[model samples]
Target chain A: MTMVAQTGANTGVQGNKTPDPAKRAASWRAVRRAAITIGLALATYELIARTGSFPRALLPTLPMIVRTLFAMLLDGSMLMHSLYTLYRVLFGFFLAMVVGIPLGILMARFRRVEQFFLPLVSALMPIPSFALVPLFMLWFGIGNLTTIIIVFYAATFPMIFNTWSGVRSVNPLWLRAAGAMGADEHKLFWKVIIPGASPFIITGMRQSFLRAWIAVVGAEMIAASNWGLGWVIFDAKEFLNADIMLASLAVIGFIGFAFERLVFGSLERNTVMRWGMMRSAKS
Target chain B: MPLIEVKDVSLAYDTPAGRVQGVLGATFNMEESEFLCLVGPSGCGKSTLLNIIAGFLTPTGGEILIGGKKVSGHGMDRGVVFQDFAQLFPWRTALGNVAFGLEMKGIGKEEREEIALQQLKLVKLEKFANSYPHHLSGGMQQRVAIARALAYNPAVLLMDEPFAALDAMTRDDMQRLLADVWKTTGKTIIYVTHNVAEAVYLADRVIVMTPHPGTVKAEIPITLPRPRDPLSVEFLDHQKQLLNYLGQGTSKAA
Candidate 1:
């Protein structure tokens, strides 16, 4: 009986698309459900915190963590830590771009460059950024330099690989067309090759930033920088200041999310997405 | 003297199987304001010949003379319209794509843009001047490509089956537009195509060639009036004549 009913419903939907209003309503409901689900989880966590399954000191409640975060912000310590993390990440990321972009372009454009760099990049790429934290700390000392170097090392490979493939995979027909249209080598590179490879380069930057963000936090934990969200969390572990650790973790996550959504989002808005090499997500 | 002269041009490629010729001992000439089409089956090396004329390829044999000057490499004088409509950089607006050639020549941006807009008008795409290539339809993209190829105002235009990718309706539209562009510009053109109807419609003269070591088989001139009807008796007669030549070329080759 249920099978027959299901078959009848399937037949009803087979020939007709779900109407636009229904689809929009369904999506709106989904958003509402997601918000409700998150609220419920937080409520449950708060309930558990009050019940005290574990010590209040080790497992601080959400409110305590929020208060800690607010107090730290008021004192400007949180801001300073965030700034330190941001500075290190940006500097190292810039270094990666400086080395990776030109190297990638050369590798793609010239056979000799590819022959030299490919093996080197392949060998260096597989070693995780955390694996290099000790080595980098040894070389650069335990501070911003070590953290920044780790970020650079983590970020550079993706940038290079993406740019290399992007340039190489550009439409050959466009090259010939541009060449036949009387474009010189310099003109061709700027006009055709660069724009052609930009979408991939942008993607490379996004991925590189993501990896660098992860690497910076881990490097800070190991290298124990005087200031940074990562260092705060690590420092909090000693005092059993779970509230401070949670607060710092929140800040780190927020920064990563903000950079991914806002910074790279606008970069994409201005470049490849605007150019139609990439499609916009929302209808 | 002819505006462009081809003297026994040939290209050979070396493979594991040894030497293979792309085009062999092909000699032709184009007078100023002439509309010539290279028509044959696939692999006839018509495109190769067009590329050589465009100076994208240097022929292993013979010389291509433009205004009695030996062709060395690609130059602005030869504007090529590829079969795939490889105009309009994806990153640029329609106007920007057209302006690319002028910009390369070191023309000021404002001046080049004005000229680009003019060429866009020539292709009836001035309204879409700011639109990227992806936003435009395939037909529109080809029109923009034509506009770009002409914006630089090349002395000779080399087209390699520019309409082959379009739908039948769009193809006809393109052919009419191309004919108008040709009559207006009076620039020498060397077009390559496999379609007999296309060559018959747009060209002043058609050169048919055979495949497998490509060479011209026949040169047939169509003296039909402007806006030639595809269904007309005279048009069908020319098509028949070209078909016969194509069949004969195949049989003789076999």
Candidate 2:
């Protein structure tokens, strides 16, 4: 997921450098290839559905899936489910950032802080978020709490690790230069350290958000939160409503793609790219 | 009283081999607005001595004084330029970087930018005010650094081989620019370099240092006029004299 977002960003940067006609033709080729691939996949699915080799309920046609998606949208259940999922993921992501960024900076700057947190973070980071879902479900009950906690757990490690590395890797020469220019500790951190470390911090945010997106859905499925898109998919499995399942999956994929492309993409453009911290990534 | 004084300053640290002295009893004094250069071979502790004066490192013995006050740590009165091109903040445009020292002094945005622009003009980098550090060439970036160091009006400027990374042509241009800045600002500068010709070309007085527990070896004064040519007879004589001091230092180390 991180690699996908990075490559997407890389191409966007490269698009500026390519000649106009060549760039236009390349994009048009990409659009045509995408259309053909989607069209072929839908046709194959529809053909298999008509064969009736599997039950009609288990393998719905494209029209049936589209109709179910539209009905759910018109009645607002799909919107509510999406909103619920977004809330959980966003809230958990926010919590991870608030805690992880400061902690990481502290760990990097102070020896004692690094000593205290390094061991604990290392021990906890390798434990997958899903492994803790059952334990959280027992502790917090099968609802928003368990799901949000899982997302937070999934997101926090990357945030902490990336921020830590970013802060640590800031060139020492800048620090000395800033100090010699009469920057106190507070000024140094705000002006020199934070801006210098911004590239890694931004990358950490992207990675953690992707982690939270994955964790929220999986947690919703297991914790049986009735309102989320993940719960809808899991609920449809019992009733053999594969059309609803496919519709929910499509919505999930679309939202994740939108956030990755629009939200973080603009963020990179504004901060790191504008500042020239990401020149190496363009090639 | 001298404008700046280094009194028997020394730095020693224990390594796996044993105690290694960085600078041993290095003592010197500079008059106000004087252009001083420390010239030596590698590991001569010229840089270490400059770092001590910049307040980045505390000497284990002796002390430094600026304007009759004991130096403790980094202060706004002194500005330092490092050799590394990465010394400039990558996030800031040339203007913002030049304005950083003023910002640290709590100067207002409008005024600081105004002063920073004037300093950039002094370095002839007014046209690149909007360009980021990475976009600038090595020599241009060093010029921005010089602008930044001068913006806040530091009493003394410390330069650690600021043009060491540039090509010969760029280095020559930078040397001329630096000499112009020194004359215009009238700020005392202590420049560190291993290049004998560079030291002779720029300094009013060149302090030659010896390596292997470094100490001051010779202090040769160059009274050549401004815009001195490097190939001129007197300039070559000064270079040859400074090189002799450097050669003696290395031979003693061996």
Candidate 3:
């Protein structure tokens, strides 16, 4: 009801406002260690580049990669490619959630739903999205449609399975308690079942998004989409632009990291952790 | 007429090990504003009988009637408190949990919150209304559960070993609190417990049950004064009498 204890919220704020010296010192040390590790790795790679083992075309220097990245960003090509990749992944991921969540709830609640879908889902889950890229291209043609479908296919399984497990694992005691308290079927599902199953549902979303991110890149590469990060990397390979390819790879990695940490992490904190259903590692 | 009637309720189910009779022809009638306790060892179906009264389960053969009407399923007339701490919805605060029944009955938010706060105050947990179930201790959580059950102003309260998980000291305190609440509300309570002392201390009448194909063994009326003393001679005599009934159960099996 949002009427959480004042002491709890106050303590949370106090913890951040007045961090103990020991914790501050420990955190600083971790930052220093990370910086040193990155510096050493980059120095080793620069040394190898100077020695020119294979060729500059095959293995560009760090500066060359950075220059290419900056050039792409300035010309707006990198942003456009990233936007395309983001759109496909988000679209497919949401579609999977819309279809998968209700389906999972149905499967958990009704035996007939499980019987009808279990075998089909089990059979399709093992098949990788990349394997279907060519088949989808032939059917739907090589474009956004094929890539989005592949992403949706890759993401839907985890969403459905995790949601099904979550609903099933909801404590039977809670269900009985709700029932005895005069909650009808509709109220019970919304008030008790959904909240109880939310921890698992959120976990499913996180896992499915990760799968969708991976599937989108692979699908884009194979389907030869003109605008995605995957397509840019694949296209750079043909022109022997090693720096451009590496730059695109870096963008993909950064976006994935941001979504995982910034988006999903905050979501977990706001819902499950706040509800006391889950504990945060840091807290 | 009795406020509640359990007319020869029998529940039998076919397990992989053949037929299992959970409760065989168990029957009882409870008066209005009476404090009744179902006492027995594990698997004696004391809890099962309580579930039947709460309408969580339907007896295979017989029926349970409340207020002269047969109970079809769970209803707002009877409120139930379970032993498990997980019974409270984790996402809701204590006030929210207490107000859940009222919400289901379509009460407005501000009014339900007012009623929930009053219930919490009755249980001496008004200050903790905003606390989540996980943040509360076992005793506190059980108190919140009690508050939640009582919030809807149900005609009857059915509790299944509600204080069994607490420490001895806390259990004693809860018993005293429960007696106070029962006196104030004057609602009929059918409590299930394994602790003989708890039954003797709190119940106006204790119904002792036995394990093998669980059935009611004896019903001993406790006529002790209000705020009954566990160390009192009369109370100890009552406990001893109940113990003998339970012993008869195991002895007959042997």
Candidate 4:
């Protein structure tokens, strides 16, 4: 929606030109540059593998890794592992969202809540989620329970921190204006406070998802479940199946990239971008 | 009863250094549909007084009555337009922001939008109803703020230097637009400003407040006709009187 005015202005400036052709050329330039960089990197890797500087079993060529990835997908084992991992991550992320958001809003609104939670969040935040994995494994036992808990632990802190600051940082002027317009406590929270604080809260969600993704992979590797991409990579390492390991790594990277671009990107486009609180990078 | 009556209202608050008196014994009365202005130098507490009457802040002493009822807290009857435009919600379209007060008043969605669009038309920005606040110019944004404040049909509108941020040409245009709106709406306006010329141009009566526990020094009635030229001799005389009143306060402080 924010782009509507800008789009009109651009078309007017271009006059007779369709606008799409020039825009398409600029995007094509970016794609060609990226393709050349990727091609060069792949060629270097293939050259190094051929020279045999390291064990071929330890460092599989890019073609071998791609083949392994295709084979696993055909057999459906990779899909199953991915589904199991997604289930754990989503569950843990959901739990974090449920707890962190309300807790943060409460902390911002009330002095007592802030006093109670601030010190606790600070002390606990410094301890990494992976450090808690060994302890959680001891407590919850290996498998889905430990993995999910670790993801939850990783995701919760950023959610709380961002939301707390978001609510606090709400423009005082808007709050005053709303109050002046007859907004009661309930109306103030819903109309002014929530929308005003939304940018920070959305940023917090993005961060929480990123943390959850990383935590799930690491926890799956250490907690070694029967089915997970991380587990497959670690298991493949023991058998010197470098190709399998590399394939899983590529899948992990692809999934992370997809969530970041497709999910959070669209979320941003719909909310803050439309609101004019944030502009998309190119525009 | 006068539309608004302020009887010896005062306010004090504590800062890190010590206690500060925001206002003291600020007394006045505004008749129905009266255009009143509070003018003084910085630290004069004119805005604080306006805030108190708006019921956004409680007076630590005395009382304020609106339509002869003692003001308790912010209500639907008294709408406030703030300096800095206090920002229209960036997410909401101009129509949505204007409709906000109606929404709080619990008007149905369609009905509120209808009223909001009408108010937008009043401000002459009807075409920008779908535009977000950021997309509009500063002057347009302030017009939307005014439309929003006026949407719920408040008896009196409280303004805190509403044109302070605009450029001189835009500010002048806004003042005339506001004066026209005031005539048609017939809403009692308690406008706060530091500009002496502005006080003479728009106000029916100027309450020249003295600083350091800001209180009204004198109330000068503007007998000048509407569409009164700011450059006219009579207008200049009124401006001179306001300047002297303000000068008395600062010179006394010195």
**Pick by lDDT: which candidate is best?**
2
Q: What Cα-based lDDT does every candidate model obtain?
A: 0.86, 0.90, 0.88, 0.87
Instruction: Evaluate model 3 with DockQ and give the value.
Output: 0.73
For residues A197-224, what per-residue lDDT tens digits would candidate 3 score against the true structure? 9988888888888889999999999896
Give the TM-scores of the predictions, in the order they appear. 0.92, 0.93, 0.92, 0.92
Specify the highest-TM-score model's number: 2
- Model 2 whole-model lDDT (C-alpha atoms): 0.90
Residue-pair clashes, model 1: 0
Better of 3 and 4 by DockQ: 3
Error of 2 at A143 (Å): 2.3
What lDDT does candidate 1 reach at residue B8? 91
Q: Go through the candidates in order and give each one's DockQ.
A: 0.66, 0.77, 0.73, 0.65
Which residue runs of candidate 1 sit more than 4 Å off their true CA positions? A1-37, A281-283, B16-18, B248-254
Model 4 chain A, TM-score vs. native:
0.88
Best-first order by lDDT: 2, 3, 4, 1
lDDT of 2 by residue, A101-204 (tens): 99999999999999999999999999999899999988999998889999999999889998999999999999989988888899999998888899888888
The share of true interface contacts that also appear in candidate 1 amounts to 0.78
- Write the residue-wise lDDT of candidate 4 on B37-91 in tens digits: 9999888899999989888899999999999999988888988898885478898
Worst 10 residues of 3 chain A by lDDT: A1-10
Q: Candidate 4's residue-wise lDDT over A164-250, tens digit each? A: 989999989888878877788999988888888888777777788888999998999989678998889888878999999888888
Ranking of all candidate structures by their TM-score, best first: 2, 4, 3, 1
CAPRI band of model 4? medium
CAPRI-style class, candidate 3:
medium
10 residues in a row with least lDDT, candidate 1 chain B:
B245-254
**Which stretches of candidate 4 lie above 4 Å from their native place?**
A1-27, A280-283, B248-254
Chain A TM-score, each candidate: 0.86, 0.89, 0.88, 0.88
